[model samples]
Target: MTRVLLIGALLAAVFWVFSIVDCALQPPIRHRGVSKPVWIIIVVVFPVVGGILWFAVGRARASALAARRAPDDDPEFLDRLGSTSDQDERIRRLEEELALLDAEDDDPRWRRPVPPPAASQSTAPGDPADKPADRPGDGDDDARDQRGAAGA
Candidate 1:
């Protein structure tokens, strides 16, 4: 009995407070029976019944609901005429990109990075490139030689 009474009292207080806040935040015309100031007075005067009525009877229509919702949830905006071609174009572009990515995956340039040099193949003494080549011996010296020959 005590618990029930306490719960009911808490609920009444919450509803009263939320009603006051909601009434204050809402636009004037949205209140069904009275203006914003009157609604605030009513909610404070008759907390439970007034709060319940505020939600039940004073609720806004779908269009008015849009004023409070995110743009995505705005019914009018979502229902507005749109071109299917735009979606199709986006999908086509994405598919083309994905196909290119697939082709890249097959190409060696995009292949999984060469595995790190095998543990057994120690780095050559004083090699400038740290842990070059996925495996040992694939090193800076060979690359430098090729460049040097090209330069000559």
Candidate 2:
């Protein structure tokens, strides 16, 4: 008998703790009869009875859960979105800016062609552009002259 009573008391204590934690942790919007703090106080003050009351009265109803909807489905949420024409105008402006940028990248005026060196311009002997063929009496030319003479 004493063991039964002890077990009952232990169960009641666990229930009271669970109720208090549940009430405290619940969002203010989920509380029904009173505010969250009040629910927690009720559970703390009344123990088993307070826990039962918190579960029965303070908690929000299951049907109320249906009020929540995805932002895309909610009328208030959809109302906040502006007209499609306004979005289209923004998109059109963005596309025009992108086209303008691409045009700038491709424009010949933006990138001038590097002109080839004039035929009249003199090059130094050590210049990288001064090839052996460009110089008179080069070894290759002498060799070609020898070969031509031998062939003749």
Find the candidate with the highest TM-score and give its number.
Answer: 2
Question: Tens-digit lDDT track for model 1 on 47-90?
Answer: 99989888887756557553567767877777773668877998
Q: Write the per-residue lDDT of candidate 2 for residues 78-135, one digit (tens) a residue.
A: 8899889989999999999999998778777888799988787587888855665433
The number of residue pairs in model 1 that clash at the backbone is 1
After superposition, candidate 1 runs with Cα above 4 Å error: 62-152
Off by over 4 Å in 2: 70-152
lDDT of 2 at 43: 92
Against the true structure, candidate 2 reaches a TM-score of 0.46
* Each model's lDDT: 0.76, 0.82
What is the clash count of model 2? 0
Residue pairs clashing, model 1: 117-134
